[model samples]
Target: MLRRFGSKFLQNSLLLTLSGLYSTAALHAQQPAVNPAPIPLNPSQKAAAIAGNVQGKALIQQATALLKSGQLDSAIPILQRASVLRYVDPTSHFYLGLVYDQKGMSQMALENYTLAIKRANALGMDSAQLRINLGNTLCKLNFLKEAEFDYKRAIEIDDKNDVAHLNLGRVLLFKGDNQGAFRELSRASALMATDPNLPLYQALALKGMGNNEECKNQLQIFLDRAAGTHSDPRVISMAQNLLAELK
Candidate 1:
């Protein structure tokens, strides 16, 4: 059964580097156990499955190309097919989760990310990035408690993970834990100062604590950097909208 877990093209090609949301890493396929238990497959069944695995790999490559070109709709079906293959590994499922995420299919994203994490753990691979990915999906679903747990667990695995700090801060803000949000956002900003979202979140935390002036200051800082260097239209718009709502 494990013979289908081929070493060829074991490296996942997709790199999920979405800032403030999903973290990234290519999934490495570990070799199966030596002399793995044999499961009886009829000749026809074996042939068909091997062919399916090849098709799965091709679909994964196609999906990766589509994702890189920002053709999310085209990538989704290919990734979905790849995930169902008998030899499909964590990487395929992880990419499927990412594609679903990009398409704003939060429920589907959560499901696939969960599957990816499970497969990663089963394969004895590191799952820190998958945890962050799943945590982001949980946040999108407003599952703050679960999201916090995932982020904290990821932080425990790697203390220097700035994305975990940033996301944890956002979740805390949503939970109305202003002080906690402030502390985590501060840590995240200290780790990556150029992140425009950090100050924007910190400002929200300050606003929740009734520090209107401080909040305004933070928003201004966010706006200045976001518009000048970082310059994400969404970030700039969010900061400007918040600033307008404040004064």
Candidate 2:
């Protein structure tokens, strides 16, 4: 699967790093083992179906190339056509969702991601990364509870997925589950020691838990790491204000 996107895609669009998208595994051990019964087809029918799939794969390849070149508009129609083809790759819908997300069409992105999930599930290609992507879209739409479910599902699919833990923690923090957020963020920090955002999030969770001193310490750590980096100015400002409040 073409996991990497053009520089214009997902650039500072997510709070977490894009590195997770590339490192994710495509299959999970916990996925259902039962395969769907195969449908019997005559020679001519099977040949036609195989040809259709080949065409779908070709369209997906074309769309992927367009996406990598930052030609989002050109990729959309190709991906759309691929998505509706018989035996189409679920990744066609995933890429479509990514294009829509980059274009700031959140609803369309959410719908496509949902379709991708359904198709992936049917094909036994459901993965933690897929759930994380869907969760992120739901979060953008302010569907916090639904986002929480998807994040949790991602965690279940791959407990070692630090990105899933980080996102779940953020959602929990927003929902006032400070302790839950703290636990998940702590796990994320343990898994990805160098992610500067973890300490910032941990600080927020601590503040919500009335651990002001620990919050201040984490804030200072975040500030130190964020300095000379391309950290979000709003996040830096918020951290500074919180640090001052604890003083």
Candidate 3:
């Protein structure tokens, strides 16, 4: 537990020093979320496009199976071939990017996501989400300013994007602007009445603001939830320990 805490602490520090170019969230910036939404093609039209174009659908299915089975390297070629053949559906690109991102191939993930977004950027396009994703990737690469650009644009497009707000809060926290972090995170928590994983952060923010009673209350709630669901052990632990500290 101590080691996990230390590791998390180091990760936060590194996120600040290494990825702190701008105050933007990096949730999916490099590829998936940062990339544009997939344009929906009619299923019949898509099937017709590849009617004689080789077994694109089959290959994509194979790639999916491979991914689910944990054969990442094997899935890559199959997915890429499908992508190159116009057999690549938006779902294919999205999942392909998912695999690439999981493997730390940020550039590859970004490329596929971009392709998916461009192909699917019409009606169903969640442009703001794409910007946030790309912003996240940008932050990881130390392009803080660019990341900031993406986040700000995302806010402009949709101020109510909860993930965007939460991500921005994390970015602020890493930047050591505790007040900024508190404000953003507090808003996020208020919006998170439906999400049970955030009380720990809410507690942290309250504690930072010297609201020990509020912090303790949030911590108790966090512990109660954690015991039932195991959804946030680290947060529960931290909240508990912090509550003890404040006492």
Best by lDDT: 2
Give lDDT per model, in order: 0.69, 0.73, 0.61
Model 3, range 174-222, lDDT digits (tens) per residue?
5566577667667766665344545655665565565768767877877
For TM-score, candidate 1 versus 3, the one ahead is 1
Least accurate 10 contiguous residues by lDDT in model 2: 22-31
List clashing residue pairs in candidate 1. Answer: none
lDDT of 1 at 127: 61
In the range 132-187, model 2's lDDT, one tens digit per residue, is 87788888777989989999998998899988998899888777788999999999
Where in model 1 is the C-alpha error above 4 Å? 1-55, 86-88, 210-213, 228-247
Which portions of model 2 miss their true places by more than 4 Å?
A: 1-38, 193-195
Sort every candidate by lDDT, greatest first.
Answer: 2, 1, 3
Error of 3 at 197 (Å): 3.7
Error of 2 at 108 (Å): 0.6
Tell me the TM-score of each prediction against the true structure.
0.69, 0.83, 0.58
Error of 3 at 58 (Å): 6.0
- Stretches of candidate 3 exceeding 4 Å from the true structure: 1-71, 87-93, 104-111, 114-129, 132-160, 190-196, 231-235
Worst 10 residues of 1 by lDDT: 7-16
Q: How much does each candidate deviate from the true structure in C-alpha RMSD?
A: 14.1, 9.8, 7.9
lDDT of 1 by residue, 27-145 (tens): 23121121212347899988887787788879988888877777888887787887777443766778877777777788998998888777666655546577788888887777879
